[model samples]
Target: MAQPTLGIMTLYLSEHSGVEERSYFRKVIAQAEKLGLRAVVFTPVDVDAKNKRIHAYVYDTETGRWSRSWTPFPHLIYDRCRYQDSERFRKFRRFRATYTRLVYLNRPISNKWGMHQFLATSARIRPHLPHTRVYSEHADLTAFMRGRRLVYLKPINGTGGRGILRIERQSGGHYLVQGRDRNRRIVAPKLVSAKQLPLQLAAWNVKDRYLIQQGIPSKLPDGRVHDFRLLIQKNGSGEWEVTGCAGRVGPKMSITSNLHGGGQAVPMTELLRRRFASEEKIEEIRKAVYSLGYAVATEVEGRFGRLCELGIDIAIDPDGHPWLLELNPKPAREVFARIGEKETYEKAISRPLEYALWLYKQHYGTSSSRRRSGAGKSAASSTR
Candidate 1:
């Protein structure tokens, strides 16, 4: 029998190309090989919708290169595309509409403003969410920043901590604007009023398409602010689980604890232990971290249907309260590799493949047992 085909979909940047090479693809191929599945790579543009065929791309491990081949439409699609308002995404959506029964592993959530509005409906999630308002007229900023010690001006569509400004209301009745440069260096400037906000945001190349969020103090005693990147993914049985977590501590004066800004990734337990003297306090933090991570994933999945994974960023205030910063649909797992968490790092790579397979079986009534499944047990089976 032909193996079940699972396709990984990414947006193509080139018209002439159907496949792009990535280090993670190699890992996916290896994992799929053991699970009796053929892993195919493709872009939406590469699909011959009229013919119901795809110019599928596959990797040659022996030759260390990618080769294009023709294949039938995949049994299932794992959507990892970074969606945009462009025609490409729109066309893909139209093409996807033809397959009414095709299983989409996870629907993409790309709009920051939309996601915030949906998650806000959950009372459990609301406490952790920072007070946020859309940036529009000068009065919006003026009203939101009033009586706040610090506020963050973030791009509504920003990711990886890009295009963010930490505005502090100074005691002298002036505004302190601080942001990060492309080089990860701090770009601190002083602004006199809301009118100057545009001058500070001129570099961002945006106009009022931003959010003003209350800033929680996340710095520790050593003057370093840290963020916990908690990764959540679905297992073979189709359940949300917290795979692993690590603390990303930013440079001494950096606005965000983003790894893109040369931040250090440390084990979460180690950082919490050293920061908290009381074992009870540390245990409380541990519980809070896991609970919040699960809550965010489940809450979002309920509000926004069919999410296979989530990257939840939790920041701890000085008093030990965990604040949910933001949730990412596509999260980078390389930080675990840098931290030497081998088990967690390996599971991060394999869970998506396992979940993809499980989704096929669930909808198609295809049975795959552990004994017949050579893919072995999932990473979720291991203790973190």
Candidate 2:
């Protein structure tokens, strides 16, 4: 007799041997195994030096134990891999072989034309977005800059406050443009406008793709520009739900409120009460966030249907209107740690685990099959 099988995919695991990082993956893997399922982590590259295996260890939640096992090919995947390194990409293709179902949540979607196409046609989404334009030529960017008082130049595929620029009109023909360089350095904001932009762009630019977005007049409460991060997850019932929501306050005038950009995280309920006096205004924001999440989940699942989770970055204007900043298919859990709250941080990890479990059940079928057949557990479970 054979036990039921489960396949698990993890986008990242620690390369180092420290307890800090290793403990996190261990906990997630163990929880899956405890819930009567096999768990394996798929990595872009093998972390251990002794063997070239992509899957590492299986954690026993009941016993609170971990040991080397034959890597269980995952039934479902949890994508946490931020970016692909050379070594990781080589391993990614190999890992794709074993699993058919993936809770991709965020598979790397880098194609600009495809993204633009998806967003443009998504009737549920188009209205919530700010005016956006993609351009490879300098002429288009210059023209757009001249027309709009404020614009943001963003690398179409970039993430984590990387390679993003905010341009603001300054005195006379001068403009203040702040953006990140290729190496993730903050090049001091340059004073340039349409007149100086061409020369400066030609000299300093490294990205092959860029988008000039009309800057939404983001509201500042207590002198910090703020945005909302809604964490949407799929439950066992197979419906999308808002697991958590937080407000990010950019460290005064920083174009991006990304946690990496010296921003502070506040509870969304706190911001709504403190910043807006009207209940109607707050309700509108709540409605927009909820609507946007559903639309994005639907649209994203339509395009990258395998993905199961999303970290949606949404912004609000002075009038309390909502706009889409970007949808993170591969949003990290580390941001919640910045909030310095234990309960919020725990939900960040646990919600994803719940989604992982939901995906597992969908792919591998019911656990009772294992018990009814008198099978101890699948060899695949031990392998994980």
Best by TM-score: 1
lDDT of 1 by residue, 1-384 (tens): 446898887766555544344677777777788887788788778788778888877877667788889888898887766545567777668766766566777765646777778878888878888889888755777788778888888878747777788888876567788787645577766665655765666655545788888999877778777889999999886789888998898887778888878789998888887578888997898789899889888777765567778888888876788988888887878779878999999999889878877766655553464344432355333111
Weakest 10 consecutive residues of candidate 2 by summed lDDT: 375-384
Q: Please write out the lDDT profile of model 2 over residues 99-208, one tens digit for every residue.
A: 33443433556444457667878787888777877867777766777767788888776577777777788878787877666555666777876677777776767345
- Model 1, which residues run further than 4 Å from truth? 13-21, 84-100, 181-195, 202-206, 366-384
For all predicted structures, in order, the TM-scores are 0.87, 0.79
Cand. 2 Cα-lDDT: 0.64
